[model samples]
Target: MPVERSRRLESYNLADYDRLPQCTNRRRLAAGIATIGPAIAEPIGRRANDRLPFPPSTPVGNIVLKLHQESSGALNTITSYGDGYVAINLERHEGSIIVMPEGAVIEWPVSSFEALAPEHFEALVAAAPEVVIFGSGSRLRFPHPRLTAQLAKHRIGVETMDFGAACRTYNILMSEGRRVAAALLIEA
Candidate 1:
């Protein structure tokens, strides 16, 4: 039995050795990295030198620093938002409002999620956003599917969330150049 086990081990060792060359060839092919030459290194070095260590002289750095500055040619940015209000372009607005990324801030006729209806989404459809973010007052609440049926027919997507989360998501989507609208409901 001992001799048979030794023979089995030797066979396993021989099998492993047979695979070594094939494995090395596969690794080399997988890497697929061409030999680096001065052509690529020179352009990379020049581009790196041209870029500033910090952000360029633009309002972009303000956003990273959480400072109240809007980017050039950017749509209205939500600077501050809370339970019953959201600030657009540094202007405080009360009541429900629909914020379009490239358009105006129109007053939404909804006071709360409980008051939501199909008509409430009419303005959003008219605004023609690719996606609609519904901020359900102070908490995450979803309206009946029937209420958002109009949006679905228009091939628009809807995301439901709390007021704070909706505000943050809207800003991110808007900054990414997406056609988005935020239907924020502020319960009195």
Candidate 2:
């Protein structure tokens, strides 16, 4: 009779009572306990196995640029070309720019270029672009007096260059149609 009903359900005592835990037994107990309380809970189970979370920020819109060619080492790699092109990976300690646009990925933290006053040039002239390059990564500087009087009171037309001539003049004025937008500062 099914081996005496599996030896009477394995001799039955299943810890007497307190049941409700099995989601695969709470994934083998070792993530974020919900039960197993008290009894010196082993220093709260060794500080919940030494805490570990942050790893979920990476979602914006079409993006793909991965070029970490051992400039020092640590940018892992992920290249296959997506839309535009601003791929440069050099890490001996740090250097990253992979804004691949096609599905998702926006990692922009260029290393050396910081001079945007006038409340960051009036919030980049209220994000109403028509032309606003400004790589200044490789260095050329010039944009302070209240961000040149708020881009001359919203006449928005600033093009301070360097980061590879401001990424080739914002990709040739976005390929001759114009409506450009770039604010780089790469080199870490």
Candidate 3:
């Protein structure tokens, strides 16, 4: 019995799991990644953000660009995100702004995450989209949840994400004919 146990132990290393490379299931891993590959590229839905390298960006000058869908004639889509600016509907905009398909581009005066005031969220009530995508700059920084109380009263939903992610998510939601609004903070 001791000898059989010894042989079994020799077949598997004590640190087998710890010694794993970036990918463990070599053959199956490739197939699995391929399965969710498209989702990893541009994840959709409210809870589909499983991948980290989302809305891949290319750097230009001080901007990091991630272009989403194209506009269907008058329908708006986020064309790209550049460093401290974003291009929507082939037009480049600097600073923060609120975007909606077939709606006027409303410029927001927010500068950075720390500058986010409750009134900032309060102001979005007028836009009145079913859902609001809050792009908290280049990285994901959640605002104080309480700030959205007013919007919540009107039964609006808010999803916060990075600038690039928000751009992609906005297009994804818009394409599905959902009432979506994107409030992007592009300065920092």
The numbered model that scores best in lDDT is: 3
lDDT of 2 by residue, 1-188 (tens): 35544333233345742354322333333332333333225564446434422112222122221224333233222222122334433222123342211222234444444523455445556556676776655558866556557766777777787666776666556545555556655555
Cα lDDT, model 1, residue 109: 77
**Candidate 3, after superposition: displacement of residue 156 in Å?**
0.4
| Alpha-carbon RMSD to native, per candidate | 17.8, 19.5, 16.9
- Listed in order, each prediction's TM-score against the native is 0.63, 0.22, 0.61
TM-score head-to-head 1 vs 2, winner: 1
Ranking by lDDT: 3, 1, 2
* Candidate 1 lDDT by residue in tens digits, 120-144: 9876887788999988878788888
Instruction: Give candidate 3 regions above 4 Å deviation.
Output: 1-71
Off by over 4 Å in 1: 1-74
> What is the lDDT of every predicted structure here?
0.75, 0.47, 0.78
